[model samples]
Target: METSKRLEQALKKLYTAFHNNELNPECCKQCAVGNILDNTDSWKHLSEYHGALKLNYVGKVHQSFGRKFNGYSPLELLQIEAVFLKACGYELPLHHKNKKPKNPTNKDILFSGLSETVRFLCDLDGIPNVMAYTKLFEFEENEKPKYEFSVTD
Candidate 1:
């Protein structure tokens, strides 16, 4: 699919922030939420028909989490962010790398944050439940799933 220029810019910013260890959780969370909502039917309709007015709705979504947006608590919003990130192929933190390091590194902070976010989001409804799919496929097959590592991961 062809990504919108705005979305591409947002992704580049996110990647730079991640690599530089300069990620602002709040801003990244808002951007992720915005990107996710922008892809939804309702938001798409608004964007297509109303143009700049759609930004108002995005802002509302960003603010709504404080008051439990779409019945999701503030904590749940954070989880949704993590799930979204993972779905987009962001790597969560690992406890060990090649069974050598038993502890998490400074960079692991990013993973830990994402991991916590995904854990919470999975507890809610209407969101894509990746765990169910990942687990089912993992156990149903004898061989581990093959993944192509990329610089982003």
Candidate 2:
């Protein structure tokens, strides 16, 4: 199998374990990173220039994790992070060599909408909750922003 496929499988496996309540947050996060490294196309670049993969992966991981977990548990957080990394061409099991960079700011949580297309990410270290998009558009009498659809977990 291709390295990418293997990485993807590992990441999904981690997520599945988490959804099944079979793993701890720290373990899940740590294990999933292996996939990230194995899949990074930047590995060649990082190899040619020391630290390139580490810098590139850190930024990529930060961005993906920022997008996936809007408001959820640590498990959910890792799942989303894994999803983003996979999308960006990292296979899964993000590499330890990729090395996590310190986030410039603490905020990295997901928010659904500030506009129809835009979401404001909450700080990573803070609480997670869906930032309602309804507040942006004023409704006519017949048109509510679909709050009933959103109320459940």
Candidate 3:
């Protein structure tokens, strides 16, 4: 169950921010990458536009230099933000006229964004998705599988 230090810290920060009503997909300081980076808006400078994967000059420089913020590369931070925004119903490169969820602060909406961000984080760290529930099915009362993988096969 061990993960990289950054992954563990980021997950804890994300969880705390979500439960504390601090997560805001539109705010650079409160967004997924923001919270992971200790609620700093500096990551915003990594891209020319919000939700864009293409790194800006500063971002490119950092990426080229192998810089990492909170254990995520400049490009990775952008990708994480994009995934969070997209899953939260925001149009890419968030704008004033872009489509967004009716209730951005809704728990369910935030949860969806967090879920996708977590999945991406796990992928980046080459770890299992902690949000997955297949392990729940691994429990067995005796010597048989507690829950069959497929009942119709």
Candidate 1 lDDT at 125 equals 39
TM-score of 1: 0.28
The Cα local distance difference test for each model comes to: 0.36, 0.31, 0.81
Q: What is the lDDT of residue 138 in candidate 3?
A: 37
TM-scores of the models, in the given order?
0.28, 0.21, 0.84
Candidates ranked by TM-score: 3, 1, 2
Q: Which stretches of candidate 2 lie over 4 Å from their true place?
A: 1-70, 96-153
Over the full model, what C-alpha lDDT does candidate 3 score relative to the true structure?
0.81
C-alpha RMSD by candidate, in order: 14.1, 15.9, 9.0
Which residue pairs does candidate 3 place in steric collision?
A: none
Highest TM-score: which candidate? 3
Model 3 misplacement above 4 A: 132-153
Q: Lowest-lDDT window of 10 residues in candidate 2?
A: 104-113
The lDDT ranking, best first, is: 3, 1, 2
- lDDT per residue for candidate 1 within 39-142, as digits (tens), equals 22333221222112232454455546455334443344344554544433344321123122222223344444434443444434334433322221121123
